[model samples]
Target: MRRKKGLSIFQKLFIAFLGVGLITLTISGVVRYRAKKGFIERTIKSQLTDSRERSINYFNRTFTIPIKKDLGFIEQSSSLNNFLTSQRDEALLTKPPAERLFLHFTKMPESIYLSSRFIDSKGREKIITVGKKRVRDYATIDHFPNNVLYRRIYSLFERLKEENVGSILFEGPFRYKNNKHTFVIGISKMEPEIGGFGGAIIFLCDLTGYLNYLSDIKFNQIPIAFVFRPDNHVMLSPEKEASPGPDLYQSQEENINDALFVSSSIKLGSNNNVLLNLALIIPRKIFSSELKNALIDSVLIGVCLIIFVGFVAFFISMRLFAKPIEELSRGTGRIGRGDLDYRIKIETHDEIAQLADEFNRMTESLQKTTVSRDMLIQEVNERKRTEEALKESEEKYRTQFEEALDAIFIADAEKGIIVDCNHAASELVGRAKSELVGKHQQILHPPEEIEGEFSRTYKQHLKEKEGQALEAHIITKNGEIRDVSIKANIFEFKGKKFLQGVFRDFTEQKRSEEEKKKLEAQLQRAQKMEVVGTLAGGVAHDLNNILAGLVSYP
Candidate 1:
């Protein structure tokens, strides 16, 4: 087998140092990435939420101001309803509210027009229009009207009665018999004093103008703007027919739905085709362009900083690692060429300096060891000779065998015949050493013994060339039985094979173990009886108390 070439101290140190540094750098980069990404996401989401809230407030303020101002004007106008009713001679009185409404339209600005209608208790209705154009002369109670404008007006009145609201926002196409145009209308129920009876004041505003005004508002540099209604209507979308162009209205609807339902931040697209959906229901009012620019700047700055830090780390690692490794390499080369006295001498406070110190100590030890190499080899040879002599001395230990405190014997494997017996063995079996010799060992053992115990042990030792040891009961010459431990080993001396059996009489140990087991069993039985007595006493006391309670109750 070929041995692999070992790495030099410098090579090993360099690899270990680089591995540690790389791991540290990787962990730091991951931590920084997660922290910075979380910060950016949180910041953008907060800003978007704030912007949407502001936009909703702006819309409410702008839309409500004009309505409030117009209501104040109507309140100050001199008995406007009476003036209109008095102007009606019987011929004018019979005029439908729609025609009379045209006369009142002259009083409004060009930006607004009025229409009116009345429904009696019988469900009959009078339709009126008071706008830039006239449509009716005398009052006409109509059961049904085909005009979209009148239908919307009727719906508004019905809603007002049901909800008791002053006005509603309605959007749709309004068609007269002669013309059709899309309109957004605000309708308010007129009090009885305003028009001589209960009726509705409908203000029609052109949808196109309102949409144009909304689009014209500067939303920073946002490329599009639109209005989304609650009913899934795109009031002013950039896409006319949904042909894949950017649809601001749809985007706003999605944002609003998320804001209202999911209440979460949503990302849409990128710079070249940037799409951002800011939830309108958030407390923030979103202006698209300003938020986009802020996010783009943040991302660019973060990326540039990350790259700069990585480059700086790379340069620093090279400077810190390369020079020390080169110096260590030269020192290692000298050591490898039999210059065991060579030492690395680099001064630093890091792991590299510690490595250099360790390398110096190793080299010093190696040099000292080289000086003592011949003496060490001679000492090892003397130890081997001494061990061999010790083994020979042990083989001639016949005196120890005879005088040992423990019983010992030599026997034949097949016949179990004792070839030799020590003084202790003779004393244990109650026979003289001379008498025990040539006697079968099984004569001192029980007949109804563990089957094959000695035979199997002898066979195992013969096959493995190892010794076997076990404890068993044997009968003595006095007919007394005792436990004895027997250790047997196969040995061949002078071409005669024999088994060396060393015996240790353990009769006293066996008696002590039997006494301990009997005491433990008695202790367990005493504990179990004590527990049973306690349980019986508790049960008797409880039963006596229950019997006394029952007798006293009667």
Candidate 2:
């Protein structure tokens, strides 16, 4: 018979180090890639959501609230009410409402409203505009011969008289001159003190102009802003279309050039009325570019680290393990080649050094056992000496097994019965040797639990020479449950298949790991909230300035 050749210690150590380095590199790469992907996804979604929220806030602050305040001012205007109460007069429309009241339409830039007009309860009309634009004759107009505008105006007037409405922001009519849309922000009580059917004031502003002003204000990265009616008609879109879809009332999501699209719906009235579908198109690529670059850099760094660690590991393994193991190998080779006097010399204190000492002792013992064969040629004496040596080896094996620090248990593989256990096992389970020796292995585990795990682990140990370790809950004699990690293997003992296992307590380590994960999650949420707070502060500052201007401009 010939012995098979095996890998040298140097080769084995190099392979082990290389495998570890490659596996580490692979796992790190995967984790980094996934984390980067998740971060980018989160950042993109967050930016889109933030952009939508800011858009709504800005729209309400810049356009909606100011419009409401302007209408409120018109409702409280005593001079305008006096002007309308007396009769429709061109001279009264030309002047300011009062010394304290400034006409909003006259103060606004000519580009803002295009034209601001007033219509009374008697169906009389007068223009109170800033510029000398030709006033279209509303009486001679044939666009609404069926009186659709008149009916809508009357309905709003009724709502105002009944106090059902204070002010209204509504889409009124289309101007025939340029066929442009108009938004009428009207107030019912032009003269509230008079207390008798006081007429309303309608401000005709070009919808396109207001939406253009809104879209011009870029919140971040030049967002595209547009509005769509419930009928899917484009009311105002200074930029390109935000999304290509049939439904225009609801919010939308789209992707363009790796950019995310988000939309919000801001209705102008209370009763499912005019829906201004505001869509803001922002580039997510711009937001995630830094994270993408960071991920690439991380991958490169991981590769470099893997290479550097492999080289360092190889150098250390050569010095700590390979050299001593190589010397032991050479001594064994010499002994096999008839040089039994050769002894391995190692100066380290690790496992490899211990192996060298054990090998040397083995050679010395072999020499002592066979050296006297030439001096005394008695078969019975040699047989007796061999038996004595075998008994001594068995005693040493028993002592090592019984005195091991970790709890060890031997059970019958087929029946799951505890056949043998050491002192450590008895102390760990809090049971006497006599009480546990003949009992089933289930006595050491939680009742109604861990049964499936016990069966699976036992079957796995029976099939594998090198088994795996797993966490399990064990029950002690006092019914206290303990978390433990068990490593089990199968072996044949006295013609019976026995499962032997070592138990290690691992409750504290698992708890620490869970706590660490929870802390990381909390840190992420805190960072997100901090960003939201900063955005809110900036928006609030702008809102304060806007309100100051509205109040101080008059």
Residue 533 Cα positional deviation in candidate 2, in Å, after optimal superposition = 83
Q: What is the C-alpha lDDT profile of model 1 across 490-552, one tens digit per residue?
A: 888777778877778889988999999999999999999999999999999999999999999
Please give each candidate's TM-score.
0.33, 0.42
- Which stretches in model 2 have alpha-carbon errors above 4 Å? 1-21, 28-30, 84-104, 130-165, 172-181, 190-197, 213-226, 235-243, 252-259, 269-275, 281-298, 309-554
Sliding window of 10 residues with minimal summed lDDT for model 2: 139-148
- Per-candidate Cα RMSD to the true structure, in Å, reads 37.9, 31.3
lDDT (tens digit, per residue) of candidate 2 on 1-554: 99898986666877987887788776886788788877776665676677668767765665576666676776666666565555446545534443224344545464334445555555455434534343446531223245444555455555655544355645554443367665555666544455654555555555655566556745454646666665667765545444545453364664555455677777564343554676655555555677668888988887888788778877877677767767878887887787778888888888877887887788787888876675466776788899999999999978998899888999988888898888888888899989998887878887655444354455566677347897678888998788888899888978988889998877678888899999999999999999999999999999999999999995
State the displacement of the C-alpha of residue 248, model 2, in Å, after optimal TM-score superposition: 5.8
TM-score (C-alpha, index-matched) for candidate 2: 0.42
Candidate 1 Cα RMSD (Å): 37.9
